[model samples]
Target: MSELLEQFSAPPLIELESDLEALRKHAQKVLMQHGFPQRKTEAWKYTPIAALERRDWSSDGPDESAARTESIELPFDAHRIPVHNGQIDTSQLNEIDGLHIEPLRAEQIDTSAYVDHDPSDAFAWLNLARLEQGICIRVTHTLERPLALQFSSSDQFKQAAHPRIRIELAEGVEATLFEQHRLHGSGLINLVMDLQLAAGSSLQHLMQRQNDESALIARTEAQLEQAAHYQAYVLDLGGALTRQDLKVHLNESRARTRIHGVAALKDKQLVDYHTAIQHRVGPSHSEEDFRILADNHSMGVFNGRIHMLPGADDSHSDMNTANLLLSEHARINTKPELEIHAEEVTASHGATVGQLEEAARFYLRSRGLNDAEALALLKFGFAAAAFDALESEPLRQWFTDRLKQAL
Candidate 1:
């Protein structure tokens, strides 16, 4: 531990050496197999994970001892499920009818690869190796109120956490899910959430992460059944470093999906969001909207891919990405891709890289608003459209307040 700490000087990776060897081996193997994605790689041209390989960072299991006593907030009147340092805090969980929360056993889940697009995803393999505990949430038919799951960590020296979330929403049922990430100290958090939505079911997911000088790595994979509806909202605040990978599969016709993201970064923090939505069947629809604000020397990266397979026709999809470069040194890279193997589809993408309009700012200032107030108003207005789509009212308000504080 001493030698590792001396070499890297980061509190999180220092503690990962002795936690679990199996996870380390798997992570290394996946890294070697997949290698570092570079500019040549179409999916990783804008944001490369090569730096991770050169850094010699270690990813061990999470230590439950380092978690702070305080818990993060949830969105609705919910049954809170807390995972502290990769260990489920069942004591705080409230038993609710029509819902089941339990540890996920290896036999209960299928570890087989679901998608063949990325066979050697080092991050996915890392999650498979270090997953100490899996939280299973079954939303039965009668469940109505939102379910909130919180992932918190305070271990600055701990290596990595592969916390898995398996959510099963039964047929004809509806539920809202809130996933929040909170880091008390600086550390690396590698987490994966797998969701299964049954036929005629609906699921709303809101993912939030607010890190103070920490590195967070997260991946979410979701499968939607026929006629299922999925809505997702992602908000990423500044961190020492961060990366989020999201993959959604519209496996059946008439499945509707929408993804919205907001990112605010400053200082030297780096944040990246990568999303892939695949329409394997015909008659599915998808829309994506993202807004990013980068200040100081921060960097924001976004890569979105929409795929329509052969024989999949009548699919309608649209994507728009808008970025705000708040400083001369701040940077943002936006990539929107559409791969259409079918011709009878309406698909389009648009991306913009610019700052707030000076004229708009001046007009706001002339209307009795100070420079700071005017900027805040404009920022709020820019993000308000997407924020209003949040299914939970309290969650939307909480994020709004956070955005105000951020500005």
Candidate 2:
């Protein structure tokens, strides 16, 4: 325990803003009560932190070096916002009406508005305390084009980056947002994203994280007002250790939210997807669909939880998890939990983990295609459930092509 403290030096209170300082003190108090998350911690049970402790969390904030760097563009048409090591590069921000993108200072942000106080969420605690700067996004009117946030992180030695994002969507407005997390070197990335949707708003969010020899911990927090709708999809491919946590609160009546993802893993990679949805009021709905493809010695975990609060009458919630393992050593753990307090709510969950059907493989082989090709096609078919849910056609094709390439 003492060694862990030695590895990390907490920032002095004087260096933090008044608002941030208060949050930091609470975080510090929590850390003192519960040290870094251990295996016993429910959320951190599947993730290993020993590899993360070997490195140092130091972004040093942003500097002139960010101005000279360039972000690699994707094969999509959208307004791009490049973030280097968790800090947005203002020089690369494009101009767009009804959209405001800029740096977020500690003094200007309300920590409680985004992240909840979770004593067991070590990465979020660290993000709240060590966050130096981040990107803030606000959408007033309906957006004309999709907005993409390109996150790139690289470090020669073992380092860390904590990038924070706050998004606000106005009432009756609708928009699409994309995030691409591209890791270039060996390091740990702690990312936090908070989204708030007003009444009658709609938002579609897509994020893809691909990395090698790196560790990542990401948390997404969202709240939907009355009659609002939010749809989100995430694709996680290849990482030393990666865990993505999504928590959404349906605070008003008639709110709807859907979050799904695919973690196509390979080699010795590890990926864990955790999600929680709270139906706090009546007539709300939530659903989660997650699929995994584990090859080689990779491991994947999916934990979906649905909660119906006391007043959540006539709410509907469902969760489905499916995994396809291609190798004998490949493994996956899936759990779907439902807690209901209201009598009129309907909730259910299902999970399945298996390999390719030999009978189907034989049928395809008899049709002239080889075994490799047959399995590849079958794997693609298995992922179609989540693929078809994607709102972006180009992304759907890209993800399909990449999945084939991995095979």
Candidate 3:
């Protein structure tokens, strides 16, 4: 390595340096080679990674005490697995039928896993380096009910933790899962979830992030086989700065995917959601819907890409994004793309940035509500679209209330 490369490749923290030196060097080298994203990188134009690159992060292992105090609640009384500071709490784990949760093994590490994608993705490398322990969940044939995996961070300070998750759904299986993150710390939280859905399987993955005034970088990868159905919903409500990347591939025909997201920001927080979907086979469908509310100098970003392979004929996809700017200084950026190699496909995208509708506000005010009340009502209506799509009533109510309080 060159002098500059050698310098950047060295991690100052002794814990990380001692535990995973090779992985750390390899990860830092990738970041040094491809620095934080710039305008040239289409996928990262809206959410810059420069801030994350400058931070020096290290891990101190999992705190069993903090992990014990962390609690998470989902809409369903399903199997709960809590991961604190990147380590799963084995004591709190409960056994469930058709589901097996275990620690990730070294044999599972495959560097070629990201050969085709952006090698410099800092979080990806960071997770790879610090991923000491992770949960391996296998959903057997046709799950009896939904399952939930909760990752909670309670450490407060400059810290780093890598939590790796691998979910394998067998053929003909079906599951609705809530992958949640709760952080009370003020450091970097890097997570990577690798998922595989077998033929004729279906999965519903919902993500919620409720953290302190901390920064978070999260990435997820999913691979789907023939006739697989995958649906995702992401709700970002808390964090000083948060960014999530999703790479999904439909490797076989007749596969369908949908991504629905909602981001509510306040108090100078920044949130970004980027997604890429690739259809490698014929006749696949995908749809994306995103809603954002930014207030008090907060920022929100939405970037989505849909790719149709050369032989993927008769594919249909659409992306719709809407942003609500609650403060004058708040910013919202949306980028939607469609790359198609096939001649027969229906693809479209729509994006809009605006404030509350004066007409609606006026009508509500005239109907005897005060200005604040009217504005609150209008805002609630705007943010309710995504909540209505949720199958779990409690989760829907939880998000709705959080959104209202955020506004």
Instruction: Output the number of the lDDT-best candidate.
Output: 2
Clashes of each: 3, 0, 0
In order, candidate lDDTs are 0.73, 0.78, 0.75
User: Which portions of model 1 miss their true places by more than 4 Å?
Assistant: 1-67, 105-120, 155-157, 391-395
Q: Over the stretch 1-407, how does candidate 1's per-residue lDDT look in tens digits?
A: 22322223232332233334444455545554554445566655544444444444454444546546666766457667776666666565566677877776555455454332443355566565455566777788656567777777774534445677889889978988888777655555677788898998998888788876445677787788999989998877867668888888898988879999899888987888888898878789999998889989999999888999985688889899988898999999998989999768999899999889999999998889999999888887776566877766877898787777777
By TM-score, the candidates rank as 2, 3, 1
* Worst ten in a row by lDDT for model 3: 1-10
lDDT for residue 100 in candidate 1, whole number 0-100:
78
Tell me each candidate's RMSD, in Å, in order.
Answer: 4.9, 3.1, 3.8
Cα lDDT of model 3 by residue, 24-119, tens digit: 567666665664456566666656555654554454544556444756866667667776655566564456668777766655544555532453
lDDT of candidate 1? 0.73
For candidate 2, write residues 301-344 as lDDT tens digits.
99998999999999998889999988999989899989999869
Two-way TM-score contest, 2 vs 3, winner: 2
Q: Report the C-alpha displacement of residue 96, candidate 3, in angstroms.
A: 2.6
Candidate 2 clashes between residue pairs 3 or more apart in a chain or in different chains: none
